[model samples]
Target: MNSERDALTEILAWRRHGDPNISAVEAPVVKMVVFAVGDTLFAFPGASVTEILPMTTIYWVPGCPSSLEGVINVRGDVTSVIRLGDLLGVEHVTEDGRTAILLGHGNAMCSGLRVDRVLDVLDVLEERIQPPLSTLPERFQPWATGMFAYQGRSVLALDLGRLFQDYRAGLA
Candidate 1:
């Protein structure tokens, strides 16, 4: 048993490739939180998201745009909520109890994004994320990052920074 313990390092070295230039570092991966806004799927970088909260009572704000779903009280902090479908022109479906609020902070602002459901939290190889296609819808093209497929669904990765910037500037 002592001899076998001493041979562990040698066994590891034996598994290495002959090429010294190639290190054994694992592939880079990007963690994402995937969610749906209506039937359209979207994702946000995990680093940008602070927390996830269940759908709660939203206090309506008068004179705001339709996309602004009002605000919610989270741990005594007032967080404004937005509907991605209203901003993107995606169809809105009736809430079916799986809805959630993703608390995300972008470059310019922080808000709660109302999503239909949080489908998954994934760590995907960076290479698996593909650039947005030229045929992407005009509304999404502006705010989207690369996209990737997960579990038979095509999920569009969005840049929360840009979206927040635009939202602050009254673009959304």
Candidate 2:
């Protein structure tokens, strides 16, 4: 029974002193959902995205803001749809095989952002993200928080809160 007790003590000692080779310091990562508006790639913080839905018929609401595409009936809940491409000054291409990214929740500024396609969800390291490029158009620069190189492609990280604020202010 002494041998068994010694083995248990050794196991406890190993557990207390974990492998020294494995560094505990990890770079901070930002979780985001990357999507395409045209050829341009944009990323939204993952927490802001509620759901992604396939393209559906959008009923136009007369007298609404030009940026707003229309309303969509999502599971019996009528959600307003925003033509993100239009707001971004991107050409209004035909909405073939588009996707809607539902944003916000109850009592928040809930709406759906229509995009050409959903690219991916990524955990990008914080250090890799740089400030929004000055070369971007003035209208688009304010909404873009940062930019990062992902898989050889430069992805712009959007600030949804600022975008929505500007949208409501009739800037978009």
- Candidate 2: which stretches are off by over 4 Å? 1-21, 92-95, 102-107
Tens-digit per-residue lDDT, 17-132, candidate 1: 44466666789999999998888889999999999899899999999988898999999999899987787788767677898999999885799988888988989889999999
- Global lDDT scores for all candidate models: 0.88, 0.80
- Clashing residue pairs in candidate 1 are none
> Every model's Cα RMSD, please?
4.3, 5.1
Worst 10 residues of 1 by lDDT: 14-23
The residue-level lDDT of candidate 2 at 49 comes to 80
lDDT of 2: 0.80
Which residue runs of candidate 1 sit more than 4 Å off their true CA positions? 1-25
Which residue pairs in model 2 clash with each other?
none
Error of 1 at 75 (Å): 0.4
Candidate 1, 4: how far from true, in Å? 12
Cα TM-score of candidate 2 = 0.80
Give the Å shift of residue 148 in candidate 2: 0.5
